[model samples]
Every structure is written in C-alpha cells, then in structure tokens.
Target chain A: MFGTYLRRELLGRRRQTIIIAIGMALAIALVIIVNSVATGVRDAQAQVLRSVYGVGTDITITRPVTPPSGTDQGGQGARGPRFDFGAGAGDASGDGSRTVHSSRLTVGFGTQTMAATSLTTVQKVHGVEAASAVLSLTNTTFDGTLPSFGSRQQGGAGATPAPSGGSDAKGGSSFDVDSFTVMGMTPGGRAVGPLSATTLAKGRTLAASDEGKHVAVLDSSYAKSKSIGVGDTLSIGGTDFTVVGTVSPTGSDSATASNVYIPLDVAQKLSSQTGKVSTIYVQAESASAVDSLKASLQKALPKATVATQADLAANVSGSLGSAGQLVSNLGTWLSVIVLAAAFLIAILFTISGVTRRTREFGTLKAIGWSNRRVVGQVAGESVLQGLVGGIAGIAIGLIGVLVVNVVSPTLTGGLSSGRGVAGSMAEGARRTFGGGTGQTGRFGGAFGGASSGARSAAATQVDLSAPVTAWVIALAVALAVLGGLLAGAIGGWRASRLRPAEALRSVQ
Target chain B: MYRLKNVTKRYDAKGRTVTALNDVTLEIPDGQLVAIQGPTGGGKSTLLQMLGALDRPTSGTVELGDASLGTLADSRLTGIRGTEIGFVFQGFNLIPTLTALENVETALVPLGVSADERRDRAARALESVGLGDRGDHRPAELSGGQQQRVAIARALVKEPNVLLADEPTGNLDEDTRDEIMDLLEGLWRDRGLTLVIVTHDSAVARRAQRRLHIKAGKVKELA
Candidate 1:
C-alpha cells in the first residue's frame, strides 16, 4: 500500500522531487571535484620526488648554513651563484663532526663543506651502489663585467660592487654579487643528480675531459638571461670560458637554479677550496638497504645531516602542509556545509508539499489509514528521490572534473625550498613527460632571455588537473542519498502528525 | 449500535472558545436509518464525527457496542473505522489521481486485504452502486452524480457494520438527490447496516425511520 502511494505521489508531483534531487546532486558534485584534485596533487608530488631524487636513491647529505645577514631568504635580488639543487638537505649546528677512520681523506666542518673525497668513503659503505659530490658557490657575479645575465641591454656597465663581509668557509672567498650560483659537479655526478643528461635542455652534460677546461654549461633559464648559447664565451672569475651547452631541470630539480655548471676541479681551483664539496648524494643498492644506509650515513658523517627520500618529501610537504591539507579537506568540509543547506531545503519543500496535500492525507486517515502508513508513504517517496539525486550528483562531479581539466591553466607556486627545487622539479617533469622545447626555443628567439623574475615564476608553474577515481564517485553518491533520506524522514514525521478531521476541514 | 452521553466539543477560534456541540446525549439502534436535520454549524457534523470515531468528545463518552470509544487508542479507533464503519460526504471526496476502481479499493487498504480480493470486492461494490461500467474512469471524467456513486461504492466496499452520511445529497439536484436517497434506503434495508445521516432538508428526513433536529449546539427529537 505504501509503495503504491509513493509511486502515485511522485508521478503526480515530479517537479518537487526533481528540485530536491538537484540540490543534493550539486553538493555531492562539489565534493567529488575537490577530492579528485587533492588526490591528483599528491600523486604529482610523488612523481616529481622520484624524478628529482633519483629512483632507488636512498640517502642525501648536506649542511645547513644561516643566510648572510641582510640577504633576503626569499632569494629575490640576491645575486647568488646558482648551485644545481642536490637532494634536499637538513640543518646542523656548530660544526658537529668527529673524525673516524676511512680509506681516503674525509673532512667535515658540518656547518659548511664536507671533504669532496668523502664520496669514496660513502661509496665504500655496504649497500651503497653509487655516490656523487657537489660544490655550490653562492653570491657569485659574472666577473661583474660581462653583460649581467637577463638584463638584455648588453655591456651596460663596468662592474657592480660586491657585498661586504660575508664569508663561505668552503668557497674561501667573498662573493662579488648575490645574483647567481655556480655549482661544481664531479665528472659523472650529472648522471645521478637532479640536473642529469635526461633533463638537459639544449646542451651536452659536462664530461671528464672538461675537468681542467673552463667550459661551463649554463642552466637554460640562466643561459637565456645572459643570451649565451652553446660555444658562446662566458667570463667567470676573470677567465674566459666557452659555453658547452644549456640544461633545464623541472619538478624539484633544486640544482637547476645554478647559473652555470662547471667541472669540480675548475670550481675548486677558482674558489681556492681544493678537494671540497658542499653536498653529497648517495644511492642505496636496493630498496631494503635504504633504511640501513640512512642510519649508516648518519653515523659516518655525524656532523653532516643525512636524509632519505621519504624524509626529504616530508620536509618539502611540511612546508606546504597546511595549504595542501586545506585544499585536500576543503571538499569534505564544503560538502558537509552544502549538504546541510540541501537537506534543509529538501525538508522544507517536502513539508510544504505535505501541507498542500493535507486534505488527501486526511481522506486517507478517515478511510482508516494509520499514521505509520502515511509516514511510510512519504518516506518511500523521499528515498526514491535520494537515489535519483545521488546518481545525478556523481555524473555532475565527473563532468566538473573533465571541464576543469579542459579549461584551467597550469597552476604554479613555489615550495619553501625556493626557486631551485621548483625549477629542477619542473624541468624533471618536462623531461619525464617528453615536454617540447617550446619554452627553450622561445628563450633562444622571441623571449631572448627570460628575466630572473619570469624564470623563477616559470619554475614554480605546475600543471593542475583532477584525477577522478571510483572511490570519490562512490563516496559522493552515498553522501547525496544519505542527505536526501535524512531530509525525507523529517518531512514524513511532520506529515504523519496531520489529523484527518482538521485537515479535511481546512479551507485551502 | 451507537450511544453518546453528554458530549461536548469545543473549538478555540483565535481567543474565544466556540461550542460546536454542547451537552448532547444520543442513542441509535442497529439496522435503523436515523436522520439528523440542522442548520449549518448546529453540531450535526460533529455528532456524525463522534459516531464514526473520526473524533473524540471533549467531555463524554461515545460508545460503539459495549466499548467506550474515548477509552480506546487512536490506532484502535482507526481500525474500528476501517472494519465497522464507512462514511459518505457531500463533496464526493474521491482521490483525483486514482481511477473509480482504485478509489473504491482504497477503503480496503487498512484491512490488510489481498489485492485480488480487494479488487473483486471493489468491483462488486461499484456494481451495487450502479457504477460498474465506470470503474476505470477518474472522478473528474464522471458526472457529479456518477462521482457520488463512486464515493458510495468506496464507502460500501469495506462492508462496514455502520454507514455514516454527512450531507450525502447536499450538492445534488432534486433528481440526483432522490436517486442517492433511494440507493441509501436500499442498502439500509437490504444489508441491515446501521445508517446515520446529517441533512438540511426536512423532506429528506421524512424518508428515515427516525428524525432528530438541532439548533444552537442542542438537539431534540422530531417525533
């Protein structure tokens, strides 16, 4: 009997059911789209991490130094020597190092440089498949005489004065300018680090033969800024060095911020700090060896901070944790709020509908229909509406995700690791996905060299697209139906309270 | 079959209490046709409601058989109405969405009757009321008299022990009113069902076995 009544009532007044269903569907759809985007971001982060931090690479070691006083950590306007961002590093205090026996020389000032020769010791450790060293020269200027990179107004001035009195113990010299970094890479280091051959934009990687040569490979963005190309000459530290090639790193490739890459031997000779590297990246032979290797590296370089890929990811994500969490859970919280509104509207509409049909309910009551039966009839109608609404909501959510992917621009934002990590990560992604050299080509011609600001901004630009999944669809549909049923129950209870005599007697 | 003792029904209209029925005592035997004649708002409908268990008196007990209806639960009263009584109204209150046959079957809904049995009984009831051929038609498609007959079929399909009619012919012309009255008379005589009717016409009252008149919320026998 209730089923019969429910079918008849819905058929007779379809508009009301449709209106309520649509409201619920809208709420559910919003939830689905938000969750999908959140999931997509998380997945992209993992991919970029694997690319920048080599596959199977377990432990990264670096020193944390306090930024020079008066220098903006934001890195804007700081003419720093660009270092190829190595694996993300950690903090150390007070040159915490203890000498331990090793086959080759191992030196550490923990707060500054480690022995460039430490690579052999790290490689000698069990479970270590490979090891590489990096020497980053910060606050470097282009001899302060060549056209300033990215200025585009060639031969503008003689030399900009270097900042006074900040010393890097490893470089053993004061930087002339704080605009770019020069990263010194070991012969085969490019093959394993963030800015590897795979990520080179327009140049060949530095070779073992280039160790004594003053040839440098500029980062694509830095090359564009200086209007330097392959075979071009760049003056560094008062010596003319021929440009070998330009490289671009994307998606957490922190090293790509380096204005130029030169042989470790050349950098050591120029900086007057022979046989010293600032960071070391180590790869464990197997996944199972990663934990033990991290533990051993920490013990090996007690003063230097050692981190695994997971730890590095945690640090990067920690910087943006609040923002990511806000974005990820925004869907759930928004859905709850909208569902409340939808439920209220649905209930109000149902109550109003029941009120209009008071006489019909009264007639049923007078014909000996129990209040429970009346309630059942009302509830049955509502549940059916909920089911319809849930399905529609899932469809709407899927469509919304598709539309967003089609219409929205790539989203870009810097990580706390600053421009280096962002640039390298972006470059890595470009290479991994086989991105065209449209940007690189434009850098060579129309755009000439992207300004430092444009390049930094480009490094942070990441593609944003939602990846919908079965779980999101199922959850959204379930919520929509539940919301509808709850609204229906309220309406049914109100309808059941109507009295036969009074309802029939009412004028309207 | 029906008894009312000192029945008083009051309504709160805005602020004042309006006495719809005041201190009324009434009795009617089974298988008898009783006409209650009164002007509008003379408690005629209120008295009919009391006997049908559609309402409870504010002060007094309404008894159907030996049980005081005021002592029974609302659900029980609903059951009593389904199995023991039927009602016909002047408006011919047929559910507009349902066909004539469905409208008739609606009375059997609370009885837990099987669908086949309910349908068969409804069809027979429609036939008894001279609407067998009009079973599939909606109330809107039928004439006013035909609609009234559908309502009658609905009321009779339950096979109740008592039938209550409140202004059964109030909306009909003289010819249609006579036709309905004759049908009611036949049912009362042939089926031996207690019939209680509220009417405004003295001539309609003349056809009943007994007549009661009411004015200003009080009733008096017209013998």
Candidate 2:
C-alpha cells in the first residue's frame, strides 16, 4: 500500500517531484566533479614532488641555507667552482703562450653540504628502513688560451702573456666555461636515492661493482642534448668517466634530478669533498612512521633540515600551484553552497507537499490510518524521490568526469630542492672577481647562478585528469539519500502534527 | 452503541471564543439509523466529531460500547477509530491520485492487513457498493455519484461497528441523492450496522428511524 500510494502520488503530481529531484541531482553532480578535480590536482602536486625527490623517499634531510656572513654567501665557502691552475699546471707547448683547460667541482645549485656521517645517523633512527646519501656537485670546465706575453716572468694567475699563441696581436683572449649538475650516489642504494624515480632509457644503470670505478650515468635529456650516450667518456672535476647508462624521470615532461650520476666514492674523491654529502634521502619501513622518524632525525641532527613529501608538495610553484588553490578554495565553497541550496529546496518542496495534502491526510486519519502510518508514507515518498535524484546525479557526474579527463588540461609546475642563492651568488662573485674575467659570469645559468646556495629549479608540464573512483560515487549517493531523509523527516513531522478535525473542517 | 454526556466543544476563531457543542447529552442504540439536522454553526458537525472519536470533548464524556472516548489518549482513540468507527464526508474524501479500489484499500491500512487480503476485501467492498466495475477509475474520472460510491466502499471496507456520515448527499442532485440514500438504507438493513447521518435535507431525515435537530449548540429530539 505504501508503495502504491507513493507511486500514485509522485505520478499524479509530477511538478513537485521533478523540481526536488532536479535540485538534488545538480547538487550531487557538482559535489562529485569538484571532489574529483581537487583530488586530481593533489595527485599532480605529488607527481611534481616525486620528480624532485625520487620515488619511495619519504623524507629528505639537507642543511638549511643560512644567510651570507661577510664574503661567504649561504654560509658556504666560495660561491662556485674555482679552478686553481698552479705555476706549472698550464700546458707549456709554446714559450709563454699556450692553451689551458681546467675543471673544478663544487656543491650543486640550490643545495648545501652536510656531513656524510649524517646518513649514518639517519640510518640509526628507529623506523628508518633505508637511507642513502648524495653529494650534489657542479662540474665546470674552463677552456681558455694564454696570450704570448712576458707576464709569466712577473707573477701567476692574473698574468698577461705575450701575444704569441692562440691570440691575436692585440692580446685579446677568450675563455669558455661549461657547467652541469652531478649527483654522487651509492651504486647499490638506488632504492631510495636520486635514481629511484628514473627508468633506464639506454644501456645499463650503475652497478655495485662500479662503486669505486670512474663510471658515470647520464640523464636522457642531457645526454640527448649533448649527443653523448653509453660508451662515451665525459670529464668531471678533471677526471674522465665512461657514461654507462642514460635514464629518464618517470613523470611526464619532468627532468631527472641531475645531468650526470657517478659512484659516491669517486664523486667524493674527484670533487675533493671526500666526507661531505649534500642531501640524505630516507625511507621509513611504513608510511605512518615517516613523520615520527623525521622528527627523531631532526632532533638527532638539529642543524639539518628534514622535510616530508607533504612539505615538499607545498614548494611546488607555477600554474600547478594556482590550480591547486582554485580547486581547494573555489571548488570546495561552490559545491558546499550548491549542496546546501539543494537540501533547502528539497525541504521546502516537501513541506509544501505536506501542506497541500492536509485534507487527504486528515481523511486518512479519520478513516483508520495512524499518525505513524501516515508519516511513514510521507517519508517513504521523499526517500524514493531522493533516490531518483541520486541515480540521475551519478550519471551526470560520470559524464562530467569523462569530459574533464578527455580534455585533460596541462599545468606547468616548477620544483626546486631549496631556496636559490643565485642573486647572492652573483653578488658574491662581483665582490670576489670585481667584475673581471670571472669564469661563471656570462654562462652562469637561467637564474644567474646560485653559486652560494646552488638552488636548482626544474619546470615540468603535466596533464591534469579528474579520476572518478567508486568511493566518490558512493559518497554522492549517500549525500543524496541524506538530503532526502532530512527533508522527509521535517515534512513528515509537519504531517503528523495536523489535527484531523481541523484538516477536514478547513477543507470546507 | 453510543453515549454522550454533557459533551461540549469550543473553538477560538480570530481570538473570539465560540462554543460549537454545548452540554449535549445523547444515547444511540446499536443497529439504529439516526439523522441529525441543524443550521450552520449549530454544532451538528461538532456532535458528529465527538461521536466519531475524531475529537475529545472540552467538558464532558463521550462513550462508545464500553470505552470512554474523551479521557483516552490520542493513540487509543486512533485505535478505536480504525477498528470500530468509519467516517464518510460530504466532499467524497477519496484520494484523487488513487483508483477507486486503492482508495477502498486505505481503510484497511491501519488494520495491518496483508496486501492480498486488503485487495480482496476492497474488491468485495467495491462490489457491494455497486462500484466493482469502476474500481480502476480515479476520482477525477469518476462521476460525482460514482466518487461517492467509492467513498462509501472505503468507509465500510473495514467492517466497522459505526458509520458516521456528514452530509453524505449534500453535493448531489435530487435523483442522485435519492439513489445514495437508498443504497445506505439497503446496506444498513443488510449489515445491521449503526449509521448516523448529518444533513440539512428534511426529505433525507424523514427516512431515518430517528431524527434530532440542533439550534445554537443545543440539541432537541423530534417526533
């Protein structure tokens, strides 16, 4: 009887049911779309972090970038790689005139060195599953010609040679400096290191057997740009290393952490920083233990900066950050307002329905229907009405999600390991070189050069997709039903309060 | 059986107190067909409300069989109305959305009757009221006479002990009114049911076994 009566009522009064259902449907659909988009944006942020920090690295420890005190910037000595050519180090193929090539290695941009023993400290922390240390360095090769002059007889580095070799008669000489990032890693600890998020695109990755060997791996993009591949030799800090492999980052349009990768021992020895590491990547045994482990590591090494994946995600900038803000703020509020309006509409319409049915309810009450029975019928009708809306909303939501995914918008993100020291590095260089023929002056890099902090920022483009999961659909249905139940409860209460005698008399 | 002792009902209309039923005392036997006649606002409907257990008296007792109506809780009164008393309004108070058969089945809803039994009983009741063929028609599709028959079937579908009719033929023409009265007379005779009718028509009152008149919330017996 309840079903029959409710069906007849809904079919008989089409306008009311249609209005309520449409209202609820639109609200539920909005909720689903907004939630899915928000989740998609968050996932994009995670991808950006993964591209920078490597996969499976839950926490990263680095030394904070402190302000420069006096000549040293970022609290580090020397802003960039310094090539110390001794009195007899220059090639002597000619009398007081010759070609000279010198290479030097220093800490990479946007990074600061910490004691290599910090990796051991991190490993000893409870809940730490694995730890790997990396020494990020910048390799700069300076190729220049010494003019043929009599300056070698007077002094050293700044001597003006005679215009006799590799220079015009006017004593004009040109020098070129080329630089790229190098990361030193444990050959066997790729599970939570700089190479974790990369897939070998050519040849083979660094093996444990090559730990102390002068072997290197190249980033696929860098390798392609330089036209260098496996079996090719490259120079780092004046040492020749055979490129054994090329790898690419897993994220789309993202760059690997460094241009070149070499064994930690060799990188340390050639760079003349044998016991120094710039970053330590740590992985906890379980995801839930990451925060606690980070806290303990931070306490153990108070001077070091410990950051989790969430903290890193906040550092992501560019258009992707804007999208995240839009989703978190506008999308959330708009959906909330629409859903509230939908619930309000449902409540009002149901109340009006009960008001219209006063006479009918009174008649039922007078005949033999209990108040409870009549209220149940009203509630039942509303619930069915809400269910209809929920089904329609799910269909509409699915279509909306499909359209969003098909149109996958591209977002550009910029991820940096730490704050850049380029401005300070440039200032420090001017103070040191006094605007003379500085090796890192012209081709410093995109952001001048973070010679002091060595901050490196990589820009990546990602396609955003709103994924609709089963749980999100379930929530939409639950919300629709909840809206219906709320309206029904209020409407039924109104119906139950009607006095049968007054209702019948009012009809007259 | 019905009994009313000093039953009084009052209402406050726009802040002015108005007494609809004043100290009305009455007794009605089982299987009696009674008619009540009165002018507007003369407490005729109020008296029916008390007799039907649709209301509680302000100052007196209304009894049916062995139970007192005024002192019982609303839930208890609802039980009595569902199982013992049925009301037929002049407006043919059938749910407009329901078919004549479903309208009749509503009377058995509070009885917790199974769907099959409710359907079977409603069909038989409609057949008895001469609306068996029109059972599928909604109230809007049915004529005034047919709608009234559906209302009548609904009222009697539960086989209640008392049937209260408020101006049952008020909306009908002379011929249709006569037809409805004849049906009610036949049903009352065949079922040996207690029937009460409130109307302004002297002709309809003339056919009842007993007649009462009300003037200014006061009731007077007529011979």
Candidate 3:
C-alpha cells in the first residue's frame, strides 16, 4: 500500500517531484567531487615523492645539537624554528636513556653549517638498511643562455658568457633567474632514494665514479632554461660542471620549479666545503621499524630530531597542501551553500506539494485513513524526489570535474594520472593473491604474461595509488538517503497536523 | 451503538471562548441512519468531528460501543477512527495521488491486510460504488459526484460499524446528489451501519431514520 501510494504521489506530482530530485542530485554530486579531488591530491603527492624519490626510509636522524650560533645558513629556512638538537634529551616514552635527533633536511641550512658527520652515524644503528647524506642548497640560479630551436632564436644573440663570470659582454643579460632547490646525493643513495631511470629525459645520472667530477643532473625545467644537454659544461657558483642527466618533468610545483641534483662530494668540493653534508636520507625495512629505530638513534645521539618519510613529506609539502586545502575548504563551503540551496528547494517543493494537495489530504482523512498514513503518503513522495535528484546531481558533478580537468589541465595537477595506479593495484592484487600464485609465480607472471599483463604492470606502476571511488560512491548514496529522510520527516509532520474538517470546508 | 452525554466543545480562537457545541445530549441506537441538520456554523460538523474522535469535547462523555472516546490517546483515537468509523466528506476527499482503487486501499493499510487481499477488497468496494471500470482513475479525472462515490467506497472498504459523512453531496449537482443519496441510503439499509450525516440539505435530512435540528451550538428534535 505504501508503495502504491508512493507511486501515485510521484506520478501525480511530476514537476514538483522532479525539481526536488534535481536538488538532491546536485548536493550528492558536490560531495563526491570534493572528496575525489582531495583524495587525488593526497595520492598524487605520495606517488611523486615515492616513485621519483624512492620509498624513503621509515626514520631519519640528523644533528642532535643545534648548529652553533652565528653560522650563516642560506636558502629557505626549515619550516619550523630549528629545535635544539642537543644530545641527551629524554624520549617521550620517559626512558631517560633514549635520545632523539633531527633529519638532515631539518638541520640548519647553508653549506658550512650542515652537520654531515652527525648524520653519518645513523648508518651504524641496528636495523638500518641504508643511509645516504643529502645537502639541500636553496636560492641558487643557473645563469646561462638557453638555445631555442626556432628561427627567432637563431636571429637573436647567441650563447653568451654566464653572468657570474662578471662579463655581461655577450649581450646575454643575467636575468636574476628563479632559484631551484638543489639536492646533492651519491649513486648509492639511489637504492634507498629511488628515481626511475626510465623517466630521465637526457644523459645519465651520477655514477659512483662521478663523485668529484663536478657533474649534475637537472630537472627538465632547469635543463630547458640553460639549454644545457648531456655532455654540456656549465659554470655554477664559479665551478665548472658537466650536465650528465635531465630528470623528466614531474609537474609538481616544487619539483618543476627549481630542483637539481648533483653528486654530494662534487657539490661540496665546488662550494669549497669538504667533509660536510647538509642532510641525510635513511630508509628502514618497514614502517613499523620507524619508532623503535628512531628511539635507538635518539638514544644513541640525542641532539637530532627523527622523522618518518610521511612526516618529512608532510612538512615539505605542508604549506603547499595547506594552500590546496584552502581551495578544498572553499569547495567545502560551496558544498554547504549547495546544501542550503537544496534545503530551500526542498521546502519550496514540499510547501507547494502540501498546498496543492490540501483537499486531497483532507479527503484521505475523511475516508477512515489515519493521519499517520496520510503523512506517509506525502513523505513517500518527497523521498522519491530526493532519490532521483541526488543520483542525477552526482552524475552531473562527476562530469563537471572531468570538464574542469580538460579545460584547465593545470588546475588539478594531473589527478587523472593516478587513476591508472588505482585500477592496476586492484588487478595486481587480484591476480597475485586470487589466482593461487606464489610470490615467485606472481612475479614471473607479472613480467612474462601476455599483453594484458603488460598493461596491468603498466597500470600498477603508479608510485602511490589507493582507490577511493567506493568511498565517493558510498558518501553520495548516504547523502541521498539522508536528504530523503529529512524531507520525509518534514512533509510527514505537516501532513499529520492537518485538520480534516477545516480542510473540507469551502472558502467564502 | 453510540451515546453522548452533555457534550460541549469550546474553542479559544484568538482568546474568545467560542462554543461549537453546548450541553448536547443524545443516544444513537445501533443500525440507524440519522441526520444532523443545520445551517452554516450551526455546530452540526463540530458534533460529527467530536463523534469521530477527531477532536475532544470541552467536557462530556461519548461512548461508542463500550469504549469511551474522551479518554483515548491521540494514537488510540486514530486507531478507533480507522477501524470502527468511516467518514465521507463533501469534498469527496479522495487522495489525489492515488487511483480510485488505491484510495480505497489506504483504509485497509493500518488494518494489516495483505497486499493481495487489500487490492481485492478495494476493488470490490470501488465496484460497489458504481466505479468498477473507473478503478484506475485518479480523483482529478473523476466527476465531483464520482469522486464522492469513491470517498464513500473508501470509507465502506473497512466495513466499519459506524459511517459518518459531512456534506457528502455538497459539491455535486442535484441529479448527482440524488444518485449519491440513493447509494448511501442503500448501503445504510443493507449493511446495517450506524450512519450519521451532517448536511444543510433538507432532502438529505428527510431520508434519515431520525432527524435532529441544530442552531447556535444547540440541538432540538424537529417534530
């Protein structure tokens, strides 16, 4: 009977019902779109950090003591105030014997002040797989001529002397180029800090032999500006260096903006600072090993602050992420507005529905139908409207996301790139575990399977991908149901309060 | 069987104690067709509303069978209204959203009737109202008289012991009103329902087994 009543109400009030449905659909869609984008950003950042910079260590250690005062550190300051890295600090676990240390990136800036010796000791800690020392130099620009491939470039002034050479004599003016953050690393560090070799745009990465060779690998952005290809020599900070490789464009604001990599030894030599490194990158066997290892390292060297890969990523990307969150926050507020609009629309539709059917309700009450049943009939109609509207709104919202992505590619920062990763993980997990295949068989099949497997492998290659589509779908459905229930409650309450006798009376 | 003793209904509308019923005392025996006749605002509808348990009397006792109407909670009163009394209104108050048949089926929903049985019974009621072929029509599609008949059918579908109608033929023309009146009289006689109708039409009042005249919230027997 309820079903029959619901059907009749919907059929009888087509226009009003459709309007309510549309409102619900839009609200659900907004929620889905916002959630999807937020999830996308989080996944994308993790991927670029991991794939481009390998599964970084579970825990990292730096100087236990603050860099002695008066040390002039250059480049961007650590995100937070430099903590006192003094040794012998007590651990949070109240074990007075345990000490904590900072990561290399968190250590004081500048070539001379970074405590490389203190970081190297982490390698001696138990459960330590590998540790590589890194020096991050900021605000350093490469002043060189970029050779354009067009006729316009050919007609312009050719390659000129670099600005730091003290001769603007070549008509190539020093543009005060934007500085990219340069990180110095050794080839052995690549095992723990993996950079996919296939993504190298040009030349080769630094080899172990290239330690003091004054060789550097630049991101595609820097490489493009300097017009310096593999085997090309460029002067940086008064030191001549060979451009041995170029990293593929990751499109991350930080990665694309100013990143360059060079051998630690060579960078130290070029900067005239020997036996000194800026920060150290360490990796543990698993995430679980982090806290214990951090404790041991802190106990061993108390002046340093220890952080996990996720922690460092968050700190480095926090400002950027916060900015993104602001956008998402705005989106959230917009969604709230949409919800308010939905409520208003629901009210209007419901009021109109009630007013239009006043006599009908009166008639129902007159025919031995209780107020509860009459209310149910009215509310059932509202719920039907909400369901249809919610679903439709979600569909439109998804399309909107896609349209925005296409129209402004840079707006979303390649969220679409991560979709492949999500799909492949499911397939890979299914094929490996569901097919009764052992580790060896799974590995073998993954490498040797047919074209489909290759496709799967390609799909699975995302650095960090976790599927959140199910979450999005669930949230949408839940919103729809909630909206429907709310509408029903209000409509039912109004229906129940109608006075049958008054409703049947004719107006004067 | 029904009994009313000194039933009084007062409304405090905008701070005025308007009496819609005053010191009304009456007994309605079983299986009787009675009409409460009055002009506009003469308290006939108020009396019927009180009788149907739709409203509480300001003071007094109303007994339907052995149960007291004044003491029941709202929900309980609703249950009583659904089971024991069926009402037909002047507007033919058919749920516009429902078809002629489904409108009748709504009366059986609270009865916990099975879907098939509910449909069968609703169909039977619609057929009895001379709308068997129009079962699928919504109230909007039916004439005012036909709609009133649908309302009558819905009320009778529950086979209530008492059938109350307020201006059951108010919206219909004379010919249609006569036809509806004939149907109501036939149903009352055949089903032995304790029927009470509130109407301004003297012709309708004359057909009842007993007629009572009401004026200014008071009732008197029209010799």
Best model number under lDDT: 2
Query: In model 3, how large is the Cα lDDT of residue A218?
Result: 73
RMSD of 1: 11.9
Please provide, for model 2 over B1-223, each residue's C-alpha lDDT reduced to its tens digit, 9 standing for 90 to 100.
8999998889889999999989989999999999999898898888888988888889999999999999998999888988998788888888999999999999998899899999999999999989889889999999888888899899899898888999999989999999999999898999888999999999999999999999899999999
lDDT of 2 at A456: 30
Tens-digit per-residue lDDT, A1-508, candidate 1: 5566567667767898789889888887888877877776665555455544554456767644433457533122233223231222222223221111111011111124657767877878888878887665532221111111222233357764332211322211211222345667876565466454336677687888787888888778667765778989876665678888877765543335456678888877776668777667787888887988888887877766676766655433332334356665776688778888877878888788788777777778888989988887777777777777778888898898999778744543333343332222222222222222112211211221222211232223445567888898888767866776776788788878887774236232
Q: What is the lDDT of residue A349 in candidate 2?
A: 94
At residue A262, give the lDDT of candidate 3. 77
- Model 1 misplaced regions, further than 4 Å: A45-67, A70-79, A82-341, A405-409, A416-455, A460-463, A506-508
RMSD of each: 11.9, 6.3, 15.5
TM-score of each: 0.66, 0.85, 0.70
Worst 10 residues of 1 chain A by lDDT: A101-110
Alpha-carbon error at A358 in model 2, in Å? 1.1
Model 3 lDDT tens row, A245-341: 8775343322321246778776665554466664455677666888787778777666455656555444322233453565468878888888778
Interface RMSD of each: 2.1, 1.5, 2.4
The candidate that achieves the highest DockQ relative to the unseen native structure = 2
The candidate 3 chain A region of ten consecutive residues with least summed lDDT is: A432-441
Better-scoring candidate (DockQ), 1 or 3: 3
**For every candidate, how close is chain A to the native chain A in TM-score?**
0.57, 0.82, 0.58
